[model samples]
Target: SRLQIVCWTVLVISAYLVILFIRFLNAATITDPFNITIDWHLWALLGLSASSAVGAPVIASAKAAKEPAPLQQITADGPRIDTSRYPAPVTKAAAAFSRTEAEVAATGSGVLYGKAAPADARFTDIFQGDELNNAMYVDVHKTQMFLFTVIAIVGYGALILNMFLTTTNPASLGLPAVSDGLVAILAVSQATFLAGTGVTNTPT
Candidate 1:
């Protein structure tokens, strides 16, 4: 889960920084007490961070793909099937909404969808029916995440460009140092995404 991954990342980074701090304290590096040591070996941290950046979204998409079919919640005994409410078809429009029992039984013109006919002679032929049947489909959390990811990539690129053009450190532009900013951005982004679940009542 994202929460577990986030917590573990925080703990690992915190422990690494604490170890560095202790080493700084013990090594008589106090002449510039505020200064910290970070070698290029920290590139390993960057590499892991980059891997997770790519892996997280792929994991989320695979999980979404593996979600149980929506119809699994329905059962034969759950709802009484009433053909009365399902009026006979008026005219053949589309394969999904075209089959009438009379036409099907007499002329053998019916279409079988996944071994079962769709109710009401509507959506009688297509497997899973229309993908856009739900108005909220386009507004799902995944779409929002994807859009924000693109925005973040563009925004970060712009920031890097500005820093290069200005010949000034991030601190001069009221930004946190790179590592701290990365941590803060990831934490906030994760929390924002999680908060949307509460607001939207979306299942994890």
Candidate 2:
């Protein structure tokens, strides 16, 4: 319990730290930007700060009391698991949603996830029924993490593009404040999701 509390505290603090760093960077490094109308530094600071408020859940969820895991069920003979709804050879990365007896008897699990994997054989792969079925309030954690990852990649890409364009000439794409804001939102969102489950942003 104490360990969980510490982990959660760190998660919330991490969000705040990211917001603070962004603000500081805007203040120090971006005071002026080629005489633009709006001081984008300020915009970036405000937007990111608002998004960082998503850390509120971390402390709240952490301090909440824990619930016990479900125990085994008892039968006339001793203990028995009513896995009638579960399928045989359940050798999938994850389990399927509860299926009706009639449907299970007819369709089977193989019929359920009838789809192709990604060619790269990476996490990008999704079965046909993935989007159709709702597994959790959030889907795979990898996808959520990937959201921020894409944001970061785009952020660096913008900087590189700016450098390349400036080298060639002064005409190129502008910096992406929206991308930064998107990453801020994603960071805070992941923190909130982790807080709810008493999990930290630290990778599994």
Candidate 3:
């Protein structure tokens, strides 16, 4: 998610710079009253960046919907612990392994995750199981909402500044007056987003 956001921010900044360069070209050629127009390039940059910012909520929401509801799966049967129930090891490595080593690595008394089940049936606890099922979705929703709020605030502020710099009096402020300001604004936006990503990914 952090990578995606950074990529999107770079794209947005690049597009903005390109458009600003074009505007410079326009400003240089056509004189009088600083008539400026934001063409396709400007709109496309905004669209792509805005979409990327919005994608977090969509992805998380979709995942949340698809995940199975957490529940304690109870069975009517009891434990069947018998020495005869144990099966012979299929491979040479398994047959040679001692009892203690297997017990350490296995999920239960002796069964690794994503492998064959243990000889004795094990049941998961309600609290841990519930956390596993719902954790991602819960985090996704929270983070997505935060992302949207930040993007919206930052984007709108930048937009307002851009409009002021572009449409207002350029002659009074000189040729490159807005250039440094624009760079500063974009730098802040990217920095803040990167900081947010770090905060989000930090271990608790």
Candidate 4:
């Protein structure tokens, strides 16, 4: 969400700068060369992204706090956690004691309670689930969010370019207005992303 906000910000500012440059070159024909404005809807779109970025971590952390840490065993294929060992409705004290005993008995072994370092990070990680059980699976929420962000950026860029070409005075034109429908699409996309973070299939 933060990344999307930054991309939109840079796109708008860059487009504005290009217009300013054009106005500078054609100073004789234009009045108020630096008079550029950003639409309120654009600001709202950015605000939604910023809100999602801040809210996602908070939701995840809240969910994590209520769950007990699962003991993970480093297998030949990958790290695997035995969910059966820490059954549901177990008390916090019992869970803690069980975790300690498992840690001691498996000290020399590969069993542990932490994430293993990835051999290498990839951009595909963005579309993959963060949980152990579903890490290999593609995250539908993340993929949709990424696709929408790319589409929004590309579409807005083309809109700005067309405006610059068609307008008699590029400097006189305000920033392109974002439609209410596009803003709503982004809002729903971000809301779903946050919702997915809060509701996890795996135990923490």
Q: Number of the top candidate by TM-score? A: 4
Candidate 2 lDDT over 1-204, as tens digits, reads 222234334433443354344445555555533322223553553444343344433443442222211223445888575644422322221245344434332332321222232342433332111221222124454355445545544564465455435643222223323345554665565554344434322111
Candidate achieving higher lDDT, 3 or 4 = 4
For model 1, the stretches where C-alpha displacement exceeds 4 angstroms are 1-136, 168-176, 179-185, 188-204
Whole-model lDDT per candidate:
0.37, 0.37, 0.37, 0.68
Which of 2 and 4 is ahead in TM-score? 4
lDDT, candidate 1, 39-105, per-residue tens: 3433443444455555555543443333222212333779743424432222221233355534433
Name the lDDT value of residue 74 in candidate 3.
Answer: 26
lDDT of 4 by residue, 78-111 (tens): 8564546643222222353344443433321111
What RMSD, rounded to one decimal, does every model reach? 14.2, 13.6, 16.2, 8.8
Better of 1 and 3 by TM-score: 1
The C-alpha TM-scores of every prediction are: 0.31, 0.31, 0.26, 0.70
Error of 2 at 165 (Å): 2.2
Q: Which candidate's lDDT is highest? A: 4
lDDT tens digits by residue: candidate 3, 38-59: 3444344344446546654454
Mind sharing the TM-score for model 4?
0.70
Considering summed lDDT, which 10 consecutive residues are worst modelled in model 1?
126-135
